[model samples]
Target chain A: MMRTPFEVPMDGLPDRVTIYEVGPRDGLQNESAIVPAGVKAEFLARLAEAGLTTIEATSFVHPKWVPQLADAEELLTRMERVPGVRYPVLVPNERGLDRALDHGVTDIAIFGSATETFARRNLNRSVDGSIEMFTPVVARALENGLDVRAYLSMCFGDPWEGPVPVEQVVRHGRRLLDLGCSQLSLGDTIGVGTPGHVTALLAAFAEAGVGPERLAVHFHDTYGQALANTLSALRAGVTVVDASTGGIGGCPFAKSATGNLATEDLVWMLSGLGVETGVDLESLVATSVWLAGELGRPSPSRVVQALAAESPGRRNVTQVPAEVPPAVEEE
Target chain B: MMRTPFEVPMDGLPDRVTIYEVGPRDGLQNESAIVPAGVKAEFLARLAEAGLTTIEATSFVHPKWVPQLADAEELLTRMERVPGVRYPVLVPNERGLDRALDHGVTDIAIFGSATETFARRNLNRSVDGSIEMFTPVVARALENGLDVRAYLSMCFGDPWEGPVPVEQVVRHGRRLLDLGCSQLSLGDTIGVGTPGHVTALLAAFAEAGVGPERLAVHFHDTYGQALANTLSALRAGVTVVDASTGGIGGCPFAKSATGNLATEDLVWMLSGLGVETGVDLESLVATSVWLAGELGRPSPSRVVQALAAESPGRRNVTQVPAEVPPAVEEE
Candidate 1:
């Protein structure tokens, strides 16, 4: 019965929201340019200052497949980690996790796909084989007293396999949960899943003994359903959401998909809903803008641009077509 | 209760989601290129093919303000009025509405801002003063048996006035409702308002005898919260939602606010949630892509990029610097 000072309803409001920034690893992995280790270090530091408590900083994958993140160890070592924040890195196998453990990383993540075709195409493994691969990885990571996150890719659908079944996502989710993954990140890898798919997938997981608290939702705004799909997951009891800065990181295999949801944009969403993420909207946008600039590009987060709107004489009217005559400047 | 093969938990689903496409008018108004009248005609035709039944075709504002949409007359005259569809054109005043009516317009939308500063800056009047201006316009349009729609801009907040009080929005919304506007399109002009604000403002409207049934939402992705805000509004019983193709259209006065919610993305959200927008994802993405070329830019709709992933050989990876590069190939 607590009413806001304005006497507005606060139905279904959450106490805290977790924002997982995937920009450093997932976002930077597929980019054509190799971000300087120092540039990425500064990027993470800026995100930390903006109040991002959990950011996926780097991946320990073979540099051959993802040359963009080749400076993972150097970047992580150089960045100043905030005291209370968690910085998890992606590990494809024991070798990758070994590299992370060597750096004394307390939080680590493992990844697996749901479909055989997707697993083979994206990860070069069979469906069952990928889980088998993670079993030992998860077990060893847990024994070291490290928190583990498992990313279950293609929970929505696969390109080779048109419609992803809810049961398949549930089975794999439970596997990750049973294997001692502290949290499960369900991804619409291709941004093809709708809210219906999200609800069904989550319900299936719940029925299979994994509830909302153990889940995080990751969506790519490929078809523009990422936020909507995230909302569906939240209504079903998810509190953890993962996004990339400036909407960075497109699935290399998913031709139509863009970046994961923009962290700046996601923070805008969480802050606007009265859901506290402990992040400053202005600072988050500023960080995104700076990152886009370091990469020599405009920030994809629309909120960042809008917040920067009054930049003295920024002149939004695009450059005059060279052929067209110019108009007099407004008085 | 209803169930679908889409795997949605039918029990938790919201019923009857509606979409409002402001693409033709709002989407085209800010484009640099003056789309040929024929292309605009084809664009509207494609939107209908994608299952959007409610479309805002053109704005009858003075040519001096928006030279891009000066071909409003030709656009409406040649537009194919699809059966069972409601085509609404924006009318700024008596003259604007007169031209709209002259082109066999059966639906006309009149707009006024909720903030005094915005009203005066955008329309040269106070909030009450602007309402007074639209009263006769609304009355005249409704008397002519045209379905009248009223847009209330800055309903959530204003650039000039930070954090618009829910009370102010309610007062202005009630005035528009009282004027017999068949529907009200509430706009978050600055992209500063979040889901919490949406809940606050919508709850405000409900208290003032306004039901969600007669409402539509228009959000800017300024902070990348448009979809999130739209989702909250939908949860509050709003069915009709406003969007633009490729997230096209930025307010000339409200510069820096992101484009309107992309129609392709909006449709993706609804269809996935099993809310039934009835839009074909492929066709919708196709239309958005076509329009992007028409505007000589990449679409702001992330889903359009994602849908292209389903096809082979082509990908949307080219870095789109804010301004078109001189050496960049056109088309």
Candidate 2:
């Protein structure tokens, strides 16, 4: 059976959207099992082959913090960069920036927190201190002619702090964008946001002189609100969305909690909405299925599971085209 | 950590919504394991305790067609109907209606199909033939002073015939509504719809003189588009949404496919949007967890799994109050 949704155009949405593929970085980071650098490189290649224009290759966080991506340098060296595709690496501090610069990386992203508790716990610094930490990193990355993207985590709610104020999130986000970052991807780190909150936050950003062009949304499916929140963001004029292939990540603290929204699921909705995403859903499902096999677990993505289960022969990674067809234009 | 989403009201939505809970009927109908009549009774009672006003109790289909719900009569006899809560039973034909009337059923639903293939396969009659068959059932129910709801399945797509036309669905829905049924529920049986399709379908219904007040939406989450579609429906002025507790009812054909949109997830979004549902999130989550224990399988709902994992002690079914506290008004 065909798995694609019927094309039906909606109003007040962008003609095209940029899906920032974060499978190799945000996805694998949560995995307890270590995937080899070769497999990581192959995964990046498959994502690019499946028509993703921007893929976060790997993060430069220390091995002690994220052992899964310890082979960041090795994976960058082994992987062949696809032409016209942007590969961004996460830089935690000056050291991570230095490593990214040394590898000739053209794009880098810095992670910040909207709440004080997450800033102290994740970065070992206060919210203001973390901004101070990123100021230098952003300035240095720009000096090297690298494009910078900033991630503001816990923008909606914190585990310790119930609900982060919309004003506080807008205030922190402006600071990150003020530090020469081209885009600020709002992160629902614990995935506790809904569509109304999403609209309010975007309105808050616009009120503070930041347009939707400079904003992105990154949501987790912990409470199954990620896709619905993404729809709200699109309706509010935001165009970039962050998703992981096969829905790979899960919060280590909350065992059953889902992490990032699955890229395939997002693609299915985008395709159905008649929005242009420049992605091939079938090839993307195949890539996720193959990766699930290497990880020895079934994918958490509904589209991946449904499509993979429908055609079990598609599970063979080798059968997937190294260079799949281009995205289908909706009527 | 609290599982309830922060209240953030959106513009242009109704102040309240009616969640038509179908866990006991549509949810259990797909289950291969036949639950005891007593357990099914307890599930209905707990749903009422969670503040769902309209709960579909069970299907009166013959045992040969649906063995899982063959104990429908016993279930209705064993369960105590809460005051002010409506328990609607599915009456397939005159025989089923007789059984429901014999047991003092004041509310009933009749299932029809929009697509010709689904109508033939599911009801063993053509689209028009099925409507003809339902004419007498709906007339009798109305004459008996029963509140009747008509379900038009395969409104979005059919597994055998893909991408059903919006006009065909609207026409069939009008016929069902014309049969003295108070409301017509559009069902996306295959879960292959997006926001744009939802908006277009509702608009078509309006053009055909059926207002949103008389329309309900029942979406499956097979492809992860249910909540997003629901968001669109709400924006298009739909006030009634169908959901199953614990997200049960996987398609019998596809093993990994999700069945209905989980009620807890919908409540989370509605609560966050400042829309009154009269459901307590904590109590609802506990109910889903308790039901999961009886089924010996984890819930497919992200909200259920997250809350259950957050508070391990909440898994004790006995701890859930037989009569929980009333709904929290949004401030």
Candidate 3:
């Protein structure tokens, strides 16, 4: 009943990948139930214990806009920050950046939009206006010796606008990178992309002089294309992938909709591919199970469900040997 | 609101793929509710109408073993046989083959196992015994001018035996093909495979002289690796994939466990990759929506859910043009 996949390496992929865990901020943002700051702090600690080096802790957006993380300051003050683990908080504007700086946050992320409709709806500004708005925020963060990661949302397709063009996404991505951001995370907000689209987008970014080393991919599982697109991104030389533990952003049990790609599912693939992710699959599954109990529903993650179903006694079973003895022949 | 994905062709993949729709057989087999023969027949007809050229009609296993598909003969007799569409039935042994022949089945499949544990548990025989048993069945079917397909289950991982060796799967696959099976489908029953494992297994088969033309992949989504694995298989030159409409075998609304890779999900990715599947996404999603209502649950497919939520008028809104005019810019 061992849940680990057999290691089989493929060519043209990085030997190791950085899994950017986004459960606390992106995942909990979509939940209808409000979690206590103490519980959120515990979740962050558990994520660090599960070997995630870069966990997006919480967003500093106004309480009126994102009430889920309204207690962000309380949670950050209470949470035990692991030494080597980086907890990056999302800063929406100068006000959010001020709050993040006040909290002594060293790592921050700014959310941008590739589509005009999303930019207007989410940020109340045009795409160009939003970029102009983030200019000072990113510059100030860099000036203060903080790392800034910019998220370009709707890079693949938009719910309001369909089939985003490759060149337009590249242009916006390059603009965000030029804003003194350390890295740009491409967001397929609607999860409508395929492998080819992913490859083409990365190629465009490369053509624009934004190498894969400075790019991360944040894919949703709304259409179940997240992992396949991730595979394509890896083959195209990208090394950072974003995932949410338990796929918590959208409720899988209700109406069969999913949000972020589950961290456990992503880790399972990375583990089977012999890619070093520095994650303990067992510990991650355990954390998801414990969190699911707190959420009052089963986890949306397939790996969490599969592994949690096994008896606790079998959880620590020895891994299957690479070469097993042949079965007895019967003619 | 168009459900279609924008075509973005990827390199190293076939321009066209044959999807072996298994909804009528493998999909309903695991459901606790028993669908009527007439309903199964209608389902097959709808699948054909949705542009699936190859549909697995039903299985002739004993009713005692699979009461769900007990009406296989009735289904075959009642179902409309579309011209140029292949309706393959599962014939477990000579008895099953006799039933299929009685119904004038021209395409038939035999299920085998790569692991000794599954062979014994499922077929009451060892791996060798099962192959020996299939030898005459395949031979008889071929002699009758029926196209024979062999299913090698547990090719990736076995629940009881754990990760199966690639060589073992290739050997059994070769034996099945040698018995006159036109195609051998490798099944990841527990869905523990990754892209690397998929590539390695296909490479092993190619080294054994069985090219991708003679191979199909049947992947479950238990651990959510099915789509990613399918991507790898396609990259390795596989053009046939097995999927179930609505992902009906396992209920996603119940405990978040998924069985087969949903046809809608597969078609979404394939369509996005510019691979022709001949399936109209709208018609397919509508069919799945109707079937889900009949089954008294929502579909596990993300595509189905997303599209079904759209207003009826929006479903047919002219597809977003390949090149959209840029949005009005405001600085």
Error of 2 at B167 (Å): 0.5
Cα lDDT of model 3 by residue, B1-331, tens digit: 5467777999999999999998888888776678789888889889999999999988887776677788888888889999999999988888788889999999999888898987876777898998888888998999999999988888988767778999999998899999989999999876788999999999999999999999999988888899999999999999999999988777322335678899999999999999999988888888889888777777878888777766456633222211110121122
Distance from true position, residue A124, model 1, in Å?
3.0
In candidate 2, the residue pairs with backbone N, CA or C atoms under 3 Å apart (3 or more residues apart, or in different chains) clash, namely none
Best-matching candidate per DockQ: 3
**How high is each candidate's interface RMSD, in Å?**
12.7, 14.3, 8.5
Estimate the TM-score for candidate 3: 0.94
Off by over 4 Å in 1: A1-10, A252-257, A309-331, B1-15, B251-257, B308-331
lDDT of 2 by residue, A1-331 (tens): 4478989999898999999999889888876568999999999999999999999998877676677888999998889899999999988888888888889899999888888877776777798988898899999999999999999988898767879999999999999999999999999987889999999999999999999999999998888999999999999999999999999877644555678899999999999998999999988999998998888777878788777777743332221110000111111
Off by over 4 Å in 3: A251-255, A314-331, B251-255, B315-331
Candidate 1 residue-wise lDDT, A129-212, digit = tens: 778887888899989999999888877766556577888888877887889999999987766777767777888888888889
lDDT of 3 at B262: 94
Candidate 1 lDDT, B216-272, residue by residue in tens = 888876556677778788778888888887777754344434567787677666655
The residue-by-residue lDDT of candidate 3 on A11-97, one tens digit each, is 999999999998898888766568999899999998999899999999877676567778989987888999999999988888878
Per-model C-alpha lDDT, please? Answer: 0.71, 0.84, 0.84
Better of 1 and 3 by lDDT: 3
